[model samples]
Target: MDTGRKQNLKEARTLQIWNVIYDIIEVVVSLIAGFTANSSALIGWGLDSTIEVISAGTLGWRLHGEIKGLDERRVERRKMITLYVIAISFALICVFISYDSISKLISKETASWSTVGIVILIISLAVNPILIYYKRKYGHKLDSPALLADAKDTFICLYQTVVVLIGLLLVKWLGWWWADPVAALLIVPYAAKEGWEAFSKAQRIKNNIDRK
Candidate 1:
């Protein structure tokens, strides 16, 4: 590998490591706040964060293999697997969020206002854009589709942060009890779209591998 390629891989791996750490904290804090406030949207977001950890780890592993001079076939195989995993994970997240949101809507559950949830989301709003920018930049630098897909997932999380924050605010201030679940429901279509895109990319990779 050339010097530039090696440097890009190293930087990408470092970014993924930071992503994993941030997501682990997000998972714990969001879940705690979700349960405390009885907010389904917050819970769904927390679950999504869990998948982000897996996505980052998968890409990180792929980058590591490249840095270690793994065989071409093995690296490609790992890339294909990473895409498949990301696709399936997004599908699962869509299903879970859909079910939970609809149930909450039907039951007319009103989540309590959580100061912690608001604080965490505010922090995320500030942080996710930086992550997204670099992830995309390095993803392109390394020419890694899996990394690009992971960046898209991070973008989804940023979108969810905005939507969830709005929902929580409406619930707290305007007595819009249904807003939270509805906000969560809105995430479903986008998640499904990303999932399908990932799956399609994986299929293409599989076909290429088969031809070789």
Candidate 2:
């Protein structure tokens, strides 16, 4: 590989590593805050962070393969596997979030005001855009579809942050108990759509590989 390409892979690996670490922190904090506040949206967001960790890890593995000078077929196979993993993770998250949110709504569960939940979500809101920008930048630099797809997942996280923040604020200030579960429900369609897209892309990669 050229020096420029190698540098891009190294940088991408660093970013993915950072992503995994940050997501681990977010998962713990968000889950704690979610349970403490009885907020389904926050809980779903935390679970989403867990999936983000998996997605980043998978992408990191593919990046490692490239950096290690894996053969072209092996690298492409790894990329396809990464996409399939991401798609499956998204599908799982969508199902989980839907069931959890719907159960909460059916049970008439009201989320209590949580300062910690609000604080963590606010921080996520501020941080995700920066992550998204760099992921897209390096994804383009490397011409990696898997990396670009991961960037889309980050964008979804940003959207979830906004939705959950609004729901938390509404619950705290306006006594809108339904807003929390509703926000979580709103996340499901987007997750399903992205999952399908990832799956389709992976299939296309597989078909091309088979042809070759």
Per-candidate Cα lDDT values, in order, are: 0.89, 0.89
Candidate 1 regions off by >4 Å? none
Query: Could you give candidate 2's per-residue lDDT for residues 1-212 as a string of tens digits?
Result: 99999999999999999999999999999999999888889998998888789889888998999999999889889878877887898899898889989998899999988888888888888888888999999999999877887898999999989999999899888998999999988888888897898899889889989999
Q: Write the per-residue lDDT of candidate 1 for residues 1-212, one digit (tens) a residue.
A: 89999988999999999999999999899999998999988988888888788888988998999999999888888888987987898899899899888888889999999999998899999989999999889978877777777777889899999999999999999999999999888888887897888788889889989999
Q: What is the TM-score of each candidate against the true structure?
A: 0.94, 0.94
Instruction: Tell me which residue pairs clash in candidate 2.
Output: none
Give the TM-score (vs. native) of candidate 2.
0.94
Quote the positional error of residue 192 for candidate 1 in Å: 0.9
Model 1 — which ten-residue stretch has the worst lDDT? 142-151
